[model samples]
Target: MSSRLSSRRTRAGAVLSAALVLGSMLVGTALSTQASAAPAPDVGIAATTFADEFNGPAGTPVDGSKWNHEIGDNVNNHERQYSTNRTSNASLDGQGNLVITARRENPGNYNCWYGRCEYTSARLNTIGKFSQTYGRFETRLKMSHGQGMWPAFWMMGTTGGTWPNNGEIDIMENVGFEPNTVHGTIHGPGYSGSGGIGAAYTGPRFADGFHTFTLDWSPNLLIWYVDGQEYQRRTPADLGGRTWVFNDRPFFIILNLAVGGYWPGDPNASTPFPNNLTVDYVRVTNTPGGGGGGGGQITGLAGKCVDVAGASNANGTPVQIYDCNGSNAQRWTRSGNQLQALGKCLDAAGGGTANGTLVQLWDCNGSGAQQWAISGANDIVNIQANKCLDVTGNNSANGTRLQIWECTGGANQKWNAAV
Candidate 1:
């Protein structure tokens, strides 16, 4: 992964003064087109937490309440495009879509690495305005055709830290060079830039039509999907020893159309001018079985609660049974195969496949030992061990540590998870 990172960090405001003059006189009028209806979401998912269908009258500016433009071409990614806060760079297309266009025209005196700035584009984000902790976030868009064009729909942690320290999630990133492939990745302190943990999905060219890119994030896991078919899954285990920081904070979304970066290289004479990344919509939803920002509890074995031992946030915290008393420590949120409590993931110690392995709270890593599946009989079975979430004994006593044992139709093995 490190081999793919750009050497320079592109700042966004270095050429603002020069670019403003070009946009100063280009205030285009909004097209007054008819409003369109929003599209329905995937089946059986949680209700929509937020959505921008882009169904408003064409030619209008994007909703200011939902997004803020990121202008300037100061630097980052070694890209050649000058980002600007101009409607011509980003605006609604009269036909129910948000268009972020990258043009070949130079704007003002802004100069890229080669010479004068040869391209112009736009970037927008939901920074202070909106964020979510855990949920299924997605967007539908068609790629912009032309070499040097880079388009992405991604997110960054809202919590303060540094770039990788705060964490970054690339829901989708595609360069015109890899027209048929899109990448999804997660970056943290030790696994950022070229070292980010992620994967690629390849198929028909996305520029051929609009397709959806989805990311389902939970306590310790991130699952990526292209048009609802999952292609990749990552967790703390995949971090190679780095800390999992996503569980500790919320993240905001970003959309951009870039030109000429270290990843995509520079645009050539063959590259077309004024290409567009057309977006249909963006949607976010709480997972059906995973309570994200709004958490819930698990009830089982004499109605005792599955609680995080001592409410500790450290890895390897024990998961124990206690009398049901609502508390943050007892609140469980499920996403993909992960169950989280107290900002830690529910894990099977040492990735053990043997019965009697203890169930504990640990930093989320993509380890099979921590993956669980609820059976038709209501048994919470750990997939790696094929063992059931069990009480140490049939005794319904408090302070009993949870363990994995052979599946049995026993009362102690039954759980009513409120995910």
Candidate 2:
């Protein structure tokens, strides 16, 4: 979501329309509402890159070093709340939680798109303090609920580009009317605003208790999970040819409790005041072999290192396996989705998708051909070709050129990359 007037208003309208339709379909029906406790995070994914636990004295403001309070009326979403930096609007609960409260009174009589703001709330972001490209981002929180109430935990690209073009990933969003459901969405050029690609997860009322929301992002792929249960996955192929801008930049986190927005309309008489969106924690961890800007050797078949032939930066220079020599040619650095050695990407030759396509060094062009994913199984697969980086002819000899081939679970395709 953006801080200025943008396509999010359109996206909110779309969410409302869909909710209305679903509401009509379920008229007079009962939704099963239960309280669920947040699950423990998977023990295997223990590396932490960023985290905020919100532990502090009650009524204390958030750590300024970790979060920035965006104080203003959110005209972009046509929201009723005048967001403020006051502790009453957002504060630590002295119990390891950050509480963002939305109240009916606007002490400053803040003016909004609809004249005097009728409510007050808080919006916090990690824009300058932290940002990451590909990682496992997750939060544990309990939402606020009532008609016209909207709560979200999301991320926006950090490139300072325009909305949609910069990309937005909504890891968790809930409009009060849909008390038992939450949505995960992605917005980008050609498929943003109301046209965003997303999915919903229906479960016990989210406001009843804390739950875990997560997004696992990697080159050309995204997966969303609620309470550790996978619900949706998206890849470049799902975009129908639109640019997948997510893989090319880092994104920062946003958390807010909005009142009377386009999606939830206006708060009715039954809507409660002083409601809170309580966050237990927000954490981010690098996906193995996917962190950006660090150089390391990628060792593969017969313990040899992946190298650029002659340490050349020229495009089309062959990427080969050689004796384990600690040289720039053997040091690969991951930047976004592209793996680079000698300042050029490890690319599939000529954008080839066929078996035996020679792997070479090429300029980083933001093409799918330059994207790679080093899977948990140690197979470094080219995203565009869906093929594994292989040792040509299963040879571990010096100067053995690398190629893309069908993944055979063979030693030649397995790699131990320190990236």
TM-scores for all candidates?
Answer: 0.61, 0.61
lDDT of 2 by residue, 1-419 (tens): 43222445422101000111111111111111212312211112235688787878999999999888887776667788888899999999987789999999978878987898889999888878999998878777989999999999999887847777888999999988999999999998888767889999998899997777778788888877675455788999999999898886999898889998667778999899989999987877777332322347899888999988897776667788898877777767554455766545688776767766777877554466777877788888887777778787777788877877777777787799887
Report the lDDT tens digits of candidate 1 across residue range 38-98: 2211113225676786766667888989898886663557777788878898889877689
lDDT of prediction 1: 0.72
Q: What residue runs in model 2 are displaced by over 4 Å at the alpha carbon?
A: 1-6, 9-46, 288-419
Model 1 clash tally, residue pairs:
13
TM-score of 2: 0.61
Model 1 lDDT, residue 403, Cα: 76
Q: Please give the range of 10 consecutive residues that has the lowest summed lDDT in model 1.
A: 14-23
Residue 255, candidate 2: C-alpha displacement in angstroms: 0.5
